[model samples]
Target: MAEVLGAVSSIVTLLDLAGKVIEYLKSASHADDDRSRLRDEISSSVAVLMMLKARLSPTSPHVTSLQTTKTLAAPGGPLEQYKSDLQTVASKIVPSVGTGRLKVTVDKLAWPFKTTEIKALIASLNRQKTLFNLALQDDHLSISLALQGSTDALGAKIDNVTNDLDNVKQGQKGMVHIANSTDWPELTVPVQTEAQALEEKRRIEEWLSPLNFWITQDDTLRRRHKDTGGWVFDALEFRTWIDSPGNMLWCPGVAGAGKTVIA
Candidate 1:
């Protein structure tokens, strides 16, 4: 099954590489030297793809697919080479097509893709890849949740809540209330202005939302600032607040002397 699918995958991969190079050319993104290098790379990939095809089952279903293609149907094109190689391998697997489980299913099918169709498919795939990459870079896209309301109000019996709200998830891809304990999930609180949206984007990137902070190094007498993300504070100028042993805070001591310790 993989052999059959591998043949298709390799063909698509080859086309994708070609498509990307052409896109780079149109964008003027790379120099002539880069284009030369990429063309060389594509040629090398094709050679390796051919070698892999030869090693797979000669009776694989793709040979039947290749036999009817116009490009290689005659001589010297991809289909001709594929068909010839399969024949060389076929006898070892099966004496005749009737006896073989992997029998060829030849057809008079036309080229499945014209230049425009191929280009469009490749471009669409590229667009999807770009979108996912952009999503990954976005801090908001990396789902996180913090309690929107108080856990005490949630009640001791409340183990979960529906994640359809209070989650910065991407189409069912992010964590749910289950992760709200680790970091208060960043909210996409909507505002009336574009300025507010831009501010929210920056605030998310700046790590300003209330988070789980702990003292690390346990021995610095000066606790090192640490967050759930494992990012460490390297500067010591503000280490006094963390060093004071009495700085055990639920929040940042923002309102007043809410909680204190007696030594």
Candidate 2:
């Protein structure tokens, strides 16, 4: 539990740093689109982290249940994964601003142009930010489902144990009933908490409906669009450009040339 808590804390701290980097990028000229995307990604990431943190809080009912179970199950691995992903993103963003790196890179560049290194850094950050946000959401859902399963299993075990002890001594049946009545409420708290967490996850997904729609639309376009045989070379070139670390990909064409479809 301590390890899990520490990992969660580290994720929060790294996300704070990532936010600072995004805020810095937001101040740069002619990068409004990138800034807006970063802002949305950061907002979504923070919201997810807050929800996870609430579930893991010391006073949370979910924590009480975990303590009673004598194990931390679902969230432990996911928290570690999130920690790793955040570390990767921080590694990319932090060094970009360290001790004259940006200034030196900008100074060596030609006049009347923004720093290519900085542009590439922002592109990389945005790409990783999107991937991390998606992974975080996946982990969040997995943890919630695991908690729900654990809660259900614990509830069943309590029922079975209570029934077995009740059968062991008929004379103590009334004592068993009293004990169950006293303990059942506390035992059910975790189950209720897990249910609440699942519901909250649902609510958060609904809140991200617009972003979800955009993702879905982008994926559909990717799948449905294809270049003609005559454009095979162009398609290969476009793929290579996307794979390269160089930032921009400009494909200008006439109005009816199907540029959007190809892209």
Q: What is the lDDT of candidate 1?
A: 0.33
Compare the candidates by TM-score and give the number of the best one: 2
- TM-score, candidate 2, is 0.32
Q: Tell me how far the alpha carbon of residue 211 in candidate 2 is from the true structure, in angstroms, after superposition.
A: 31
lDDT scores of the candidates, listed in order: 0.33, 0.46
Candidate 1 runs further than 4 Å off: 2-7, 16-30, 57-263
lDDT tens string, model 1, 111-134? 222445335433433332232222
RMSD of each candidate relative to the true structure? 23.6, 21.1
The most accurate candidate by lDDT is: 2
Task: Give per-model TM-scores.
Answer: 0.19, 0.32
Q: Global CA lDDT of candidate 2, please? A: 0.46
